[model samples]
Target chain A: MTDATATRPSIAGEQRIDGSDLLGDVEFLVARVRAIGSGHAREALAPFGLRVRAYAVLSLACGSVSPTQRDIADFLQLDPSQVVAVIDSLEASGFVRRAQHPRDRRVNIVEATEQGLATYAEAREAVSRARDRSLGSLSAEERETLTSLLLKVAF
Target chain B: MTDATATRPSIAGEQRIDGSDLLGDVEFLVARVRAIGSGHAREALAPFGLRVRAYAVLSLACGSVSPTQRDIADFLQLDPSQVVAVIDSLEASGFVRRAQHPRDRRVNIVEATEQGLATYAEAREAVSRARDRSLGSLSAEERETLTSLLLKVAF
Candidate 1:
């Protein structure tokens, strides 16, 4: 078996190993870790019939008050057209509804259904657990610092 | 302009500014960021006759001795099939060559050409600059932590 398959079991194992000091590139390391965490979350959310992006759209819409499709796209850093596709999938699945914007007929307001909110809450918990597993090796201080650092990079 | 156009600049700017804090959902953030960053990188590399993934493949093949396509995918957290596409593009571009594995007939060994190495060096510098701009707000300590956290998440 390759190293990838061999190490799959210990992906979230409780180990305080430091590979950062050895690798000089921070962005590359961040990219790798993010992929792994995403893969885990993807697997967890799969059972709930939610792709990662779909969950993000639903989560953002849950907190939004009659947000247009564009608003969700902006918040999620997705393309306007991509938002339409996500909305199409969600709307078809009966997880979301599109109503004409009160002020602008050109815009479509998107809101999550009751079912969507319930699904979001459940997926949120699953994702949180997955995150906990991913961050299992880090100290509390490390997690805080890590979150802070990622915010700095992103914002 | 629509709210979509109105929000574009601020949204893009904020994406750069609060990258770390917005990483509340680790996997989602990583995937989104990677998609965005790689998209940008792909655009920039297009005129140079390269794709972002092709550049990464070249860099790996040149740096490592007798690396397999599987090795490249494993190191980069990419699917092997995806790696095949990347290598295919590189091979078609004449930046890489795939030879029969002397010891393992089932494996294909990839190597970078002279032209590939030169282009890779140039692309690496460009990508580094882009990453620097993308993470400009982050302190050295934050960058370190972000890299470490991302690596942990990936694993």
Candidate 2:
């Protein structure tokens, strides 16, 4: 294993494995950043009894579009079944509710409960703090640039 | 749910729910990109009988550092138990071997076997192709810029 105190520039949470050449791989970098971000996010949401994936669902539920289970699954790149499970748990927690779709009765739109919005508001602040701390290395301008760049790659 | 053909600009895989405002979150963007990347990676490595996590381990083993299991777990942000299980599978497939660590008797250094290196060479090419398709949105220079920014955030 490479020494943490070694001369080489290291990765954030994981030590740099020079041989992996993953250092240069875009996919690898994306994964690494997500892993680090999730760790911070999980900690921030812990007191709220939320996982990052659930937080994502909660975030969407609070949105105005009133996404359906299929919408959440496709957007999050998660399986449809997983989305249902998360929605079930959120519904049980009184964070969200399923209502009949306006245009399509067959569809059940996922909406955030009043309590869900309140929890999300607090959790959002916590997430922002943790994200800022992890991304502290970036200047605001650089983060904006990074965000713009990531938007292109992610979308 | 918002219609897929809605007037609003949409995310690549997930529809944009304007209120989630997660559209502006850096961590969310990072997660989306990685999720997309992993899907492509899993498809590419399927032919080699390797999962993305296994490929990551193999990538490290083939590297010159001669990483220990702890090294892999730390770098990948996976549990130590998960790393051990992956190594066990890789070892069974004759892709890697756990040899005595030169400096620490208790530590086992993971090294790629000749067969493992051969499998990795082919798999790496497949992974590169998949990565290119997922990141096809960015120009070569843009990918480089993205990588640099991710390095700052990741490390």
Maximum-TM-score candidate: 2
Model 1, position B55, has a per-residue lDDT of 66
Candidate 1's residue-wise lDDT over A1-155, tens digit each? 43444532211131222222224555566566766677778887898898877877777667635466766776677879999998899888788898776545777767779998888789888888887888788888777776656555554
A18-74: candidate 2 lDDT, tens digit per residue? 746788888888899988888999999999999998898999988867787777887
**Would you estimate the TM-scores of all the predictions?**
0.79, 0.87
> How many angstroms is residue B152 displaced in model 1 relative to the true structure, after the best TM-score fit?
2.9
Candidate 1, residue A152: lDDT: 51
Tens digits of per-residue lDDT for model 1, B1-155: 43445443322222222222234755666666666566666666777788666666677777636467776776776889999998888888888888876545777778778888888778777777766766778777766667666655555
Q: Model 2, residue B40: what's the lDDT?
A: 96
